[model samples]
Target: MRVLIWKDGENHLIFNMLPGSGPDYNSVVELSLGQALIAGGGFSSWTYRSGFDVSLPVYSPMAAQLDSQQIAVQDRPWVVISSQINIHPEYTQELAHLAQEHSELLVLEACPSMQSSNYSMRCRGDEVYHYPQVLKRAKFCLVIRGARLGQPSLMDAMAAGCIPVMCADSLVMPFEDVIDWKRAAIFILEENLNSLMEVLSSVSDEHVSEMQVQGSWLYQSYFSSINAVTQTTLEILNDRVFAQRARTFEDWNLPPNPLAARSPLFLQLTAPRSQGFTAVILTYDRVESLFLLIQKLAKVPSLNKILIVWNNQRKSPPHSSMIPKIDKPLKIIKTTANKLSNRFYPYEEIETEAILTIDDDILMLTADELEFGYEVWREFPDRIVGFPSRTHVWDNVTMHWKYESEWTNQISMVLTGAAFHHKYWSYLYTTAMPGNIKEWVDQHMNCEDIAMNFLVANVTQKAPIKVTPRKKFKCPECTNTEMLSADLNHMMERSQCIDRFSAIYGYMPLQTVEFRADPVLYKDTFPEKLKRFNDIGSL
Candidate 1:
C-alpha cells in the first residue's frame, strides 16, 4: 500500500492523514497520545490507561519472521549482532573492530557500504530473511538500540533460540510482568560497553545452554503467532479485571505440571541423600535372585535402608532362614496384590529422598556403578539417572509412539528397573499421574517404569539422564521373564503405554538427550588408586 510521488518544480501537494491510515479505524495505535483507548505498544511496553496493577508491564505482541526448523544445542562460542551504522554508528564501528579481534564475536552490517570482517558481514535487502538462521547457531545475540526505543532483534533472537544480550542505554523488555526474561537474556548497560566481552565470557556453558532454551520457550509460549499474542493480551486483561480468578506467576510462566513447586535446585539441594539411599526392591517370588541383589546392595557404603515390596499374594513370604544376613536393615512388605504398579507404592519405611528403584533380579550392576550413579543423581536430583536407557520414536507408518531399545546415542527414558530416582516420584506415580495409567500398568503387569519416567519428565520438563554403559539390565539368574523388557511383546506394550500416557497427559513431556554420565576419570590412563568407580560395568 505504498505509492511513490514524483516532484514537480513549483507545485505543492496537499497530504491528508488519518488514524490507522486504512479503510476503517476506531482507535489510535499510539501509546503516548490517548487517554482511554491508547493500547498500542511499539513491541515493548503496554501502558494501560486504567490499569489494575502498576507493577506488571503488559507487552503488545509484535510479529516477526519465524523459521520453524528446530536444531539441537550445538557447541557455541558466540557474541553476535546485526547492526546498522545509521542507527548506532559508534556502537557498530567499535563492534566491527572488536569482531576483528575475537573470532567468536560476529557483527552483521545493515548499512550496504559496510565491509565484511573475518567475523562480521553485511546482509543486504533479501538477505535479511537469513538472519534467523544465523542466530540459530549463536549462543548470544547482541541487541543495540535502533532508530526507535525497543528493537525487533530481541524478539528475533529469542525466536531463533539464541539468548539476547540487551546492550542499550535504557532498555525495558516486553511482557516484563509475566515472562521471566532475566532467566533467558543478559542485560548490559550502555555505559559498560567495553565490558561486554568480559561479561559474556564469564557466563558458563551450562548457563548459556539454559538461557537459550529458556529464551526459545518464552517466545513459543507468548509471541510465536498473532493469535498467541492477541490471546495473551486478552488473558492479561481478564486476569487484571478478575483478580480473584487470576493465575500465579508460575501458571503464567511454566508449562502445565506442578507449577507451584520451587526449582529442584533450591528444594532438593538441602535434602540429605548423603545420609545414604533407601533401596526399594520390588519382587514377585524371585527369592534366590532377590537375596543375591540384597546381598550386593548391602555392601554399598551408602546403604541406609532396604524395603523389599513382596508383591505376591498367592505365595507365602519366605522364611527368615532363607534371607541373607546383611549389615543393612531389610524389611519385606507383602503387598495385597501382585501388580507391577506395587513397585512405586509410597510406603512409610522409605526415609531418604534418594530412592534406588532397582528390580530384584538386577544383579549385574556393581557397587561402584551404583554409588557413582547415586553421586550423579545428587547433581541432577530432578532427573532419572541409571544404566539401561530406552528411546521413543514417532512411527509415521503406524502413526503412534514407537519404543526402541537399541543402543543409540540419544534416549528419552532411563528404565527405573535399574535407575536411581527421587523418592518424590513414588508419590507422583501413585497419585499425580494421568487417568487410569497406573491401573493399566497393573492389569498388564508391565510399564510401571515407563509410567514413572513419564511422570518425572512431565514434572521437570527435562530428559532423564543415562549413566555409564548398558547391559540392557540383563539378569543372568532370573527365574521369571527378564522383567519383560527384553521380550518383543514387552517392547510393544511399552510403546503402547507411551501413546496411552501421552493421550492422558495431552502432550509428550519426555525429553530426549544425547548424553550419558560417566565418572570424571572413568576408563582413562590414570593410576588404579586415582580412579574411584573402576568397577563400573560398560559395554
Candidate 2:
C-alpha cells in the first residue's frame, strides 16, 4: 500500500492510494503536507528534503478512484517503524536498540544525523522506495503521537492490515464511540516505553490475530476514505438521536395491540381455586429473610401457592419451623446445589397459570405490586412482564452494551421480580434449556434473569413490557450485599446470547416502541405490616 499526500493551496489537503510497483516499493508515506501542518506540524527539515513531488493530476475524481482500490494485506511478521522526525528522542533511541537486539524488528530513522549507537542511516535516493516493502513484511506498526491527536500513521497501519501499537496516552482515536479501539489496537503509555518489548511479547498469538482481523474490518467499515468517514459519522449521530428519542418516549406512535387482550390463563386458576399466581422465592443461607418473605406473602389473599427454593450447598436442616399458618398454601423445596438457575425449577409444579419469581431478600414488595404484575402479564401472555426493566443497545462500532431506561413499549431485559405466563416458561424449557442449562449453571452466571428476557423476546415476536411500579419497593437486606466474583461472568455470556440471537434470527434483540399500560392498584389487605425481626430464631 502507498499513501500519496497532495497539498491543496495553503490549507486544504488530500490523500490518495496507489498499488505497489514492486517489492522494493512496498509502502510510501508523505508527511510534509498541509494536513500535517494544520494538525500541529512536528515534521523535521529532513522530511521536507525527502518528500517527492508527483506530476499526477490532483483532482477529486482521481483521488476518489484511488481511494476505492482494495487494500492489500501482506503476511508480515516483523515490527516496522518509519519516521523521519524524532518526536521523542529518548523513545527513538530505545527503539533503535530494540531493533538491534531482535532480528524480527526493523527501524528506519530519517533524522538529520544518526544519533543512536547501532542505528542505520536513512536510505538514500531510490533506496527509499523500498519503504513499502519493509512495512509489508511487518506484523505491527508503531504509531507514536507527534504534535497532535489525529495521526494519519494509525490509519496507514490499519490500511495494510498491520496491528497498530499506539504510544499516545491522551490520544483519542476517530469514531471511538462506534469502534472499540482496545479490540483492534494496542495502546502503551509513553512512560512505558522501557518495557515495550515485554508488553508486546505478552500478547498471545490468538489475541494478535483477532486484533489484526478487527483492525482491517474497522478500516473498511469506517475509515476507508474521507467520504466513508463522513458518512459513518453522520450515521452514528443519527443513531444516538434515535436512541435518545426512543428513551424519552418521543414520537412513540405505535398503536396498541388489540390482540393483546387478557388471556384466561390467570382467571381460570384463580376463579375456582383462588390460585391466580404461584410465587417462587429463591433463598441461599438467608433463612431469616426467607421466613420474613413467606410471612409477607401469607398476608395477601391474591396469592394461591408459595414455593420456597432453599439453595444451600451445605447440608443444613430445613427451617420449616418458622412457618406460620396462613390462608395461602405453602411448600418448601430444598436443593444441595447453589445454582442460581434453580429459581426456574418451580415451572414444572406451577399449577397456577402465571408465576412470580422474587428474591428472598425483597421485604418491601407489597402484595399490590405482585397483583399488578400479574395483571400486566395477562395482557401480553406471550411476553415477559415485570418491574425494574432495563433497555440495552449494542454499539456495533464499540462492541459494547449501551443501557437505557425502559421506554414506552421496548424493553431489552427485565428483573426476575416480574410475572410471566406458564406458556412462556414452557417455551424456554423446550427451546433453550435441553442441552445448555448445565453449562450455564456451572458458569455461576447470575444472569439467568437476562438470559430469560432474551429467550422470551426470541420466542415471542414481541418485546417484553416493563410495568412501572406505583411506588418503589425497598430491599433493606440486599442494599449492601456484594455479589461473588464468579457471578461477574455475565458480560461474555450476555454478548454470546446477543450473537446467537442475531445469527439465528437475522437481527439484534433490541426492542423498539411498544405499549405500556398503567399498573393496576389493589387495596392493602393486612393492616399491620409484617417486618423482619433481627433474630431468625425469634420468628
Candidate 3:
C-alpha cells in the first residue's frame, strides 16, 4: 500500500510511500498549516493537522481526477493504517502485534516516526498525489483519535471508498440526525483493541461490501465538503425562528373560539343539528362509496346538511335513487373541474359555523367520531382539526413521512377527515391561489389537504391539531394509486408544492408548526343537554 502527503504552502511538496519499504510498516507524513480567529471570536480557525486534513478540502476535485485510475477491491491491500504523531504509542504496539500474528493480512502501517519493529525506510516526495490510489486499494482504514477526533481518517476512508474502522469513542459524527453511522462505519471500543482482528474477521463479506457502498454514500451526502455543515446550521436557525414565533403566539393568548362565537344566539345557532355544521364530501367517480358515506353521515343527528361535491368528469350525473334517502338535507353540486383541488369549492356556500371535510371513500367513520371532531374544532376553532395525521415531512429518500403512526399537534398534513371553522374557510377561499396552482393541479401534484393545513397554520399562528377518535375509522381507499406508485415525477411535484408554499410565505411550513401529543376528547358524543337546540328533526 502507498500513502500520499502534500504540503501546500511554501514548497508545494508531495510525499509518497514506496512498496516493499519494510515487511509490516508503511510511511506516514505530517504537514502543518496556519490557524486564525474570525468574526469576533464567534468562530475559531484551525490548521491542517493530518494528511486527510489537507486532502479532504480538495477531495472531491482530486477524487474526480483519480476516478479514471480506479483499482478493483481485490487489487487493494488487506488493511492500511496511517498514524499521526499524536496517536498514542500503545496503539502502534498493538498494530505491530496484529501484523506479526496475521502476516497474510498484509497490514500497511505508515507513520512519520519509522520507530515500529517492522519500519519502512523509503519515503518518496510525491506520495500525496497517490493518496486516493492507496485508499482505493485498501479494504479497511484505521481511524484513531489524536489531539482531537479522528474525523480526517474517517472522512478520508469514506472519500477513497474504503470502509473506516473508527477507534474514537467520543468523536461526534456529523449529521447524526440524518445519517446512520453504524451502517457505514465500524466502531470499536478501546477495550476491544486486542480483538480488532477478530472483529474484522467476524464481518461477513456481504456486510463489508454494504459498508463500502454506504461509506461512499455517506461521504457524498455529508462529509464531502462544507455544504453539510452549512445545511445543518441553516436547519438550526430555522428551528430557532420557529421557536421564537411559537413563543410570541403563546404570549398573545388568543381565545380558543373564533370571532363568530361572540354572537348572542351563537350557542343556539351553532349547536349540533341546528345546521351549525355542514359535512362536505368530495367525490370523483366512486358513486357507491359516496352513497355509503352519505348514509353513514345522515345517521348522525347533529349534522344539519351534507353537501356532496361531484367532481367526476363524466357528463351524466348519478341517478337521484342512487343517493341515500336520508332525513338530513343532501345536496349534490356538480363541478366542471374533476380535479381533487376543487374539494374546497363548497366553502363559499357554507353558512354553518364550521365545515367537516370527509373523503368519499371513508367507509367506517361513526357518528361519535364526527361529533368528537366537531367538539375539538369548536375548542380550537383557530386550528384545522383532523384524524390520520402525519407529523413529519416526507423524506425524499424513503418517500414516506416519519412518525406516521403517532398523532402530533404540529402536523405537516392530515388525511381522510378534517374540520375547519367557517370563518377560517372564508379566509382561505378569499386568499388568491398561487399563480402555479393550475400547473400543480394539471400535474396531479395539487394537495388540497396539505395546502389547507399550511394556510390555517400560517394564518392562525398555531399548529394544526390531530383530533384522536374514540374508535379508529377505516377507509378502503386510504392508499391512493398515485401514492402507491411512488413515481419520482409525482414526488418531485409534491416537493415543489411545499417549496412554493415556503417561497410565498417566507418560511417553511413544516418548521413553523409545533408538535405535541394528540388533544384529548372530553366526551365521545355531543352533550345531550345541547340536543334541545337542535332545529332539525331527530333520527
Candidate 4:
C-alpha cells in the first residue's frame, strides 16, 4: 500500500484501480504515499495512514507583530508558560501553584489568558501584552500542544528568540527530519509536567542564550514565511529521494558541529600540507622592518615562497634590484588599494594550499617556531594555526562580545598577524565569508585579523591553535605611530568588530579551547643542543 506515486523510476511501474469515483478505496490508500504537505493529520483510516515519514505537518501561517525585524541580544530571567487558562485547566493550576511557590523563578505572566490566581497582576492590555513581547522577556517558553495537533505558539516563541520547551510529547514539529531541533529546543514528556519547573531551573544563562540564538536562526531560515516553509518541505522530500545530495548537519546548523570542523565523514587533511607553506607578509610603509621580517622568514627551512603583499599603493615597493636578495624566491604584489583584505585575495600566483599570513612589523618569532607551527598545521589542515591568540568573552552587562586581550589558558581565535591557514580559506574569505565583514574591515582599516578569525571559526567551528609562548608580539626594536593601535580608541573598535561580526552571522560562531601546542622539549632541563626548537620565545 505504501509507494512513491510521483517518483520517477526506470522500472516505470504502473497501478490500475476501478475507474475513478473519487478514487477507489484501495487505490486511494496507495496514493496517500505520494509526496504532499498534508494538514490536519492526514487520514484516520487504518488502511491509508500517512505518518511524519510520508507527509509534512501543515500549520496555519502566523507571525508575531514586532516593531522592527532586528534581532538584538537580551537577558531573559524567567520561565514562561503561555496557554489559554481553558486549554489545559488542571496543568495550568499546577503550573500556577509552582509559580506562586517560586515567585522569582516563574516571574511574569499576568495578562488575561495566562493570569494565575495568586500571581501579581500587571498588563498593558488583556493579552500577554503584545504576546510576542512576553516571549522576548522569557528565557524559556513552555510549549504544550493545544486541543489541535499543531499550535502557532511554538513558532511564535522561536521567532521572538525565546527557547521553546517542547512539553507536547507526540506532536510532529515542522521539518523535524531536516532540522535538528535538539540544538534549539528542549523536550519534555507531557506526563512529566509536574517536573517542568525543576527542568527549566537546571539550564544556565549561557546555555539559554545559545538555545535562543539557535531558535531565532531556525525560524528566520526555514519557517519565516509560508513560501519558505513550503520550500523547506519540498527540499526535505528531495533530500530523501536523493540522499547523497542532502546537506550535512553542519551545513544546516551553519558552523562547527562541536564534534569536529568537517564531521563524521571528512577528509583527513585537504590543505597543501606536504609541501612547505608560502609566506605572505603585508606591509604599508615600514621599509626597514619589512626587509628585516623578509630576511628572517627566508631562513626558515620549511618555507616554499615569499609573497610581499605591498599594501602601500602610494609608493611602489623598493624596486626588485633594491629588494633584498634571499635564499627563497621573492615576489612583490603591489595592490590597487591599501586594504587589509588585500592580503587575503585569492591570487592566481598562490600555487600552494597553505599560506602563512604574517605582518611586516612582527619580528619576534624565531625560525624554529615557524616550522613547529607549520607541522601543527599539517595535522589540522582545516584549522587556523599560529603564534598570536585572542579570546571573545560575552559581556552580560554590556550584552555584547567583549574582546579580551589578557592572556588566559583559553584561546578562541588566532590572529592572522602571524598565523598559518589553508590557502582555500583565502577563497572563502574573499567570496564566502557570511556578511559585510570584508567590506567592514576594509572601510574601517581595522580588525581584519578579527574578521579573518571569525570567518575561519565560523566555517570550521573549531578554535585556532596557539603554538609556543606569547607575551606581546610587538617589535623588540622601533615604534611606528602609523600602526592601527596608535590611538586610545583602537581597543574599543576591536570590541565593536566582534559584536558586529556576530550580528551578521545571526549567532555567535566563535569556539574557545584551553588547548595550546608547545614543542616537546620546550621546558626541558636538557642542554640547548637537545631541543629542536631552542630559539622559540620563553615558555
lDDT of the candidates, in the order given: 0.71, 0.56, 0.55, 0.71
Model 2 spans > 4 angstroms off: 1-274, 315-317, 346-348, 400-410, 423-427, 430-438, 470-474, 483-506, 520-539
Worst 10 residues of 1 by lDDT: 9-18
Candidate 3 whole-model C-alpha lDDT, 0 to 1? 0.55
Q: Ten-residue segment with the worst summed lDDT in candidate 3? A: 36-45
Mark the regions of model 3 whose C-alpha exceeds 4 Å error after superposition: 1-274, 346-349, 393-410, 442-445, 469-474, 477-492, 510-539
Per-model TM-score, in order, reads: 0.55, 0.42, 0.42, 0.52
lDDT of 2 by residue, 7-39 (tens): 332434233333123333222344455443111
The candidate with the higher lDDT, 1 or 2, is 1
Tens digit per residue, CA lDDT, model 3, 209-318: 77777677656654465565344334433444475433232222222344322322233323444455788887767777778888888866668788888877665568
Q: In candidate 1, list every pair of residues with a backbone clash.
A: none
**How far off is residue 35 in model 3, in Å?**
82
Clashing pairs in 3: 4-127, 4-128, 5-128, 14-125, 15-127, 16-127, 26-109, 28-111, 76-137
- Per-residue CA lDDT of model 1 for 1-539, tens digit only, reads 11122233112211111223223331234332212222233322333233422121122232254566545556544555544334567776677777777877776655354444322334634354244557776778887765554555666677877788887554445555566777898988876766778898899878987887777777787767656665666677678768877877887776644454334445444345557888989888888898899889987888899999888899987988889898888898999988887778788898877889888888888898898888888888888888888899999999999988888998999888888877778888888778999888899988888898888887778888888875556787753454565578877888898999999999998899898888888779899799888887767
Give a tens-digit lDDT track for model 4, residues 268-380: 44434457889999898788998899889988888999998988868878888777889877888999999999999887778777799999988988899999899888888
Best-to-worst ranking by TM-score: 1, 4, 2, 3
Candidate number of the best TM-score: 1
